[model samples]
Target: MNSTTVSPVAEVGMLSARERSDHTAFVDGGFLYVWGGHHSVAGEEVFFPSDEIWVYDMSSGVWTIYAMGGEIPPTLSQTCGCCVNGVLYIFGGCAENGHTNQLYCVDLLDGMFTWRNVTDSTGTPPSPRDKHSCWVYADRLIYFGGYGCKQMREVTDSRRFITDEMSWVTIGTMLFRFWGWNNEVHVFDPRTNTWSEPQMHGIPPKPRAAHSSATLGRMGYVCGGVEAPSMNIHCLDLETWTWTEIVPTSTVPVERSWHTLTPLSDSTLFLFGGLSMSGETLSDGWIFDVHRKEWRELQHSHRDKPRLWHSACLGQDSDVIVFGGSRDYALLADTISVLQSPSQSHCSDLLLFDTQPLPLLRLCEDCIGRNARTLEQQLSWLPKKIQEKLRKRILFFRTAKSQGTYNSR
Candidate 1:
């Protein structure tokens, strides 16, 4: 597939040198937000960055760093999050001290954004966990499997535990330990402000963490993880509350963890990048057709951009914005990241993967964005996401100064 990228015509404000893993990224309004990922050495000694959030304005290509308000959650990563009704909600990740189940959110619509700790929520949140998948369905937030804070009833007998190697690796004098991964399901209903664990029937996927998921219609699909069933795909039917394993007729991807599964539409999903079970960071891309039950690989120009624990968010006009991930995968590594060290493959690059059939459409949109003032009436009906994307295109275009510097179609 042909893909192109757009860079900020120029950076603004205080730009952070971020090299992180297992962080969270979500889209809201006309902007994409990235927050709370950690950079650690040898997977134990963690380094926390500023209490801020990174915002990418789709219209202007201006990358701005904003100070977090309200009660900010500690610099966190390996957590999961999603945006709903302009609010970004984050749950369960490894903090500086340990794992936490604390639920926090920030309203992106609020000009002076503040992190609000949602304390009024009732019932039990899942145990503190990291690397889980968060899904927004039926106006509810659903979280599935991750390296937990403690073993739960849903934890199966098979699966590898991160702490299993505790005896070999040492951060200093302290020995690092964490709970194993489980296939537990937790749901939070914002209307009632309550949390509930559903009694799922049928055979559940093996307990695993660092997996990837995307929800379509009433079915929630999960693929790849650590240890068992790493390459298998399974979907939970939200209507019937049953799990059915999907047997792909074509090629099956390498077993991986920390990969990203992005829904391009309700029936199609995109898969890319992760650490394979054999200890390699994967860089290949695949597209899964939900109805056909087949996997097709994506051939792109950016093969060298291998990343794990990174994020890929589908943007307006079929664009996939990938950013902020480390390249050093245990294995099965794929995707892209910025920043490079002798040992660190972590990057802070904000890449735009334009996956459009006609590349010139992007240029036409840019033209419209540049002439938005004169053409306001013609573009008024566009969705907020598309409008922002069009407006933001000029942020780089103006800086390109007729050079088209960042255009790589």
Candidate 2:
């Protein structure tokens, strides 16, 4: 079978030049908001929680940076977040010192921009965690499994016991460790100023973190995460309070973590990119039909560029806007790709060269067919004498090729 070169469906705005990964992003009104991640500079990890907010105007496809005000949250990455009514809420994430339980809110309005800590409590909040999944429903934040702090007794404690009491009176001290995974379903109601872990019906999902979640109507769906690299799909019916395992009829992707799932409509979802179990960063895309419970993998130009721990959101024109992530442990920034739905048949308007390697001969042949005139126009930038000689050689080569007398290189 002959393979064909396919360009991106569309190209829009790009992120800033700072290489970053593990950031959070969401769509609010007519803008796309992105912030808070870390980048490596000469083997040093630098976080960007206090960096100016990056905003992309959906209508114009332009990016702008806005300075944040009020008390800014500490530099954080691998955080969980959700958007409700133009307000972006970010929950616990790991900072320079350790994981944090702080909640930060930022308003994305035109004339009313503010950043404030909104963690007031009439009830208990979830413990400090990172790599969690969060969704917005009924004016509340619904948080799912995440990696967080946990306490365990020292190993020696298990060996000591008293025969009479069947327990040791004095045992090894409790030790705190990070990176415990849980399947607790925590809900935070902004109106009630409280957090509650409700009793969910049916079997809960396996304890995993760095999975992806999305809400559609009365149900919420989650898929794939760490600790277990199996392609497991689970759903929670908010109205009925039940968990149901969804067995897909088509191809289910391999086990991966730190990917993103964005709802395109009430019954359709766009899934893309993650770190796979074999230590590879994936760049493939897939579409999940919620009603049919099916998965269809996408083959497009963006498939060659792996993006783990990136952000994706639905754009104004129903295009999926993808932003920063990491590839091969190297942070990626400074570019954004828009995936046009199949309904949009027009080819891409911009051509971008990425770090991913491609077949050079095929790329040149494609350019000769689609952009020969553009290349000819650019030749004017060369010196007049060189340009004239090159133009003559090109004319002679074209004439010879048309007459079937040109020799193969």
Task: Say which candidate scores most in TM-score.
Answer: 1
The window of 10 residues in a row where model 2 has the poorest summed lDDT is 158-167
Report the C-alpha lDDT of model 1 over 47-111, residue by residue, as the tens digit.
Answer: 55535777766556556666666888877756688988877888877676777898988776655
Q: Model 2 lDDT vs. the true structure?
A: 0.64
Cα RMSD for candidate 2? 14.4
What is the model-wide C-alpha lDDT for candidate 1?
0.70
TM-score of each: 0.79, 0.71
Query: What is candidate 2's lDDT per residue for 212-241, written digit by digit as tens?
Result: 888888789898886645665688988677
Off by over 4 Å in 2: 1-17, 49-51, 110-112, 152-179, 330-409
Error in Å for residue 214 of model 1: 0.9
